[model samples]
Target: MRGRTLNDAFIILDEAQNTTIAQMKMFLTRIGFRSKTVVTGDVSQVDLPKDTKSGLIDCLEFVDKIKGVKISNFDSSDVVRHRIVRDIINAYDKRKK
Candidate 1:
């Protein structure tokens, strides 16, 4: 995803919370004509070094205002996995606050 542009492609970057700022920018800029990109991450679960900022969080700060860019947020209620998964997420969320 460095120098090549993705054309007519569907790219999904999962676990993006681990990406550094520069890596996120590079992944986003790789989008080309007729391509759709989806970046998924849980900010609370970011595994970057303490001093490193998460790219997904940084991108969300500005992408909402960009045309054709859609941001969808889902809570525990939207979890499609087993019930335990949603419960786990809820527990973590509660602890964060």
Candidate 2:
């Protein structure tokens, strides 16, 4: 079946930390017309194989300079979850350093 164009829509991609750069490119290329796409992930908490690089990380490092692009880096303070959850996230984040 032919795929319909994603025109005049807003798309949020969750759990994108496991996606490779190629996959992210393919997904972004699917957008059409006035669509807005947001790809989100935690680079420090990637679950992919040890040798793999996250697409989200690549974009964070390289794509921000592109015109009309916006990147929002959320911190533990941005968490709306229970206090324990935020603490757990902060703990894990610290372990990565």
Candidate 3:
């Protein structure tokens, strides 16, 4: 990760919540000069194994307090889909618990 350098690149990592913590650390450390990275994922929705820790959740714990990193969280109010979609999501969440 440290061996390579990316300059002026915009890196967007999707489905990052499924990544392992070790992989998240590697991706973060790979940032090079003038590179901007956006790691977007819902901590509540992880596709990894049941016992595995989400990389997105773990990474947020470490970098959320950093000065340059900005973390934005969206709720159902921000959902762009129909209301039924949000309700379906809520139902799934409820079922998980």
- Best model number under TM-score: 1
Could you estimate the TM-score for every candidate?
Answer: 0.91, 0.82, 0.85
Local accuracy by lDDT, each model: 0.92, 0.82, 0.86
Candidate 1, position 4, lDDT: 98
Model 3 — TM-score against the truth? 0.85
Error of 1 at 75 (Å): 0.7
Which segments of candidate 1 are over 4 A away from where they belong? none
Q: Among all windows of ten consecutive residues in candidate 2, which has the lowest summed lDDT?
A: 1-10
Evaluate model 1: give its TM-score: 0.91
Which candidate order results from sorting by TM-score in descending order?
Answer: 1, 3, 2
lDDT of model 2 at residue 24?
A: 78
* Candidate No. with top lDDT: 1
Per-prediction CA RMSD (Å): 1.2, 2.3, 2.0
